[model samples]
Target: MMQRCFSLLFGMLAWSAAIALEAPAESHPGARAFAAELARDPLAIEQGLSEAAILATLDQARYQQTIIDAISRPAESKAWKDYRPIFLTDKRINDGVAFYRAHADLLQRLEKEFGVPASIIVTIIGVETSYGRITGKYRVLDALTTLAFYYPARAPFFQGELKQLFLLHGTRFPYATTELMGSYAGAMGWGQFMPSSIAKFARDEDSDGKIDLWNSISDICASVANYFTAHGWQTGGPVAVRANVDKNARVITPGSLEPVYPLTQLEEWGYHLGSNPGGAKPDGQTPVTLLQLEGAEGTEFWIVFQNFYVISRYNRSPLYSMAVLQLSEAITRELSKPAQ
Candidate 1:
């Protein structure tokens, strides 16, 4: 009886071992990719494409090569820091002057039509691609797909961008080859448009029925103006100003796109604007926000109005907005000078 019990126990142990061996592995590459795609859009993506095609696209995509290449280092990176000095140099400033001089009429026209400053527009072009010199080398589609499929932290957002990209391609291209190239985040053109923004805001200024952001300067300029206009750019208002902050002032909230405070409130805070700050709004005390930025020496203070806030909408970062503002100011100052 004892020997029979031992045999039964031994048989049960073997069966349990077999069951454990038969279980599926935890890491499923196919499932993970599908999950990433679905998380971006469960309904929008798996609609028409076959599972095989989807899987093949993910598999054939060069995810490994693209992810490592596309991810830009933070401003702490040597490239960004090194790149900053080049932009802030005298030669670039002189070049900015020359650029403005060459395109004075067009810049003025856009400013008049869009209520955005010509200097601001020129600066954006200068900083983005050195006035249309180096846009980017990576194909936008490849970048988006690689990041979406492989970069786990922000995969879903990139996947949504990929979806928008595909949709835009379908809407824009029926017969021609659909290919896009831009930054790692899939921002195309001198303006760096994400896929959704391209669909929503990209314009056909050339009247060619196609918006070629890659090569058309006219389209890029017009699109930038349109974007700013859509975001509430006041026709003729101050963008930013050097300010004297009172020692006693307690708090200063950043301004939003809307005019939040009256001009009276700003003056009361011991802030005053420089003469010819673009076009000042009526002196009815429109509320303004005081912003302080890091400078080489002491902190730089500026009292920004509604218009200044509008520029920030394009890029939420204060540093980016300030860069745009400073570069624009530099361009205008250089242009205003008599050629030496």
Candidate 2:
């Protein structure tokens, strides 16, 4: 999976080169090529997805100017100090507790079955879509198609998702390709799964033979839990905690969220858990991430473990992962309170 990054980068470079060389002589250059590729794909042939339908769907794809603008300025672009307050507010935390309480049995059952905490699942829903309150307004077909064919920086990635969007009809998934709605990035449901994610992780929790991310609460909860479980969510393990930096030690920036180094190794690089480190502590040999963030007070450093990295896999932003962790912990605390 590490090679996926390199492959994506190489694809971006290729797209950029092509765009620089010539003007697009046709509309949806990316979609046209993508359709051609899909027509030849063996899976597409086997799935009974008609090439004609694929072309028709691509024809219906409208390039949304707003989606382009939105992707340019994601919340993850904001500083951690500014970003934390958006999802970490009292209202969000309180709502998460209420959501958890309303579906305690199902969420807890999923937690027990999947080894992912119910609070974390609830927090993901809260973070991704405000518990299904704002899944998105743009049609998923338009968003994916627009980004697939129009956005050159990551055209290949979006195009692949667009392919998966068409293939969703062939799978056990319930939504029609054109009728689907999601984020500007084409992610759907309470968890905002992209087409590929839906294909791989979406679950029919109620056992109704269809996976519906938008309407079924059980499906939403189970699908989110399945995603976390598949991504290696560690049950009852450390997510992250504050660490004090040795003033004289050299700065250490991790290459990626994949926990590549041990806590003992980071200690030599001048980072270690402060005296007040919270959560269940991992052993010194645990592979960890040395995270640096700009906080309200000053620079913040944290030691994050595999579970923390798993959170990052949900949303690649370190800030997003931290917010999910904080919100999950906050919900757990709120639940522990004695009812007034």
- lDDT of predicted model 2: 0.85
lDDT (tens digit, per residue) of candidate 1 on 146-238? 676557788778878866765564444322213566766667788777877877877787778778776776778877888888887777667
RMSD of each: 10.1, 10.3
- After superposition of all CA atoms, the RMSD between model 2 and the true structure is 10.3
Specify the poorest-scoring 10-residue window by lDDT in model 2.
Answer: 20-29
Model 1 poorest 10 in a row by lDDT: 22-31
What residue runs in model 1 are displaced by over 4 Å at the alpha carbon? Answer: 1-56, 64-72, 76-86, 149-156, 170-178, 252-259, 274-276, 280-285
Candidate 2 regions off by >4 Å?
Answer: 1-26, 275-280
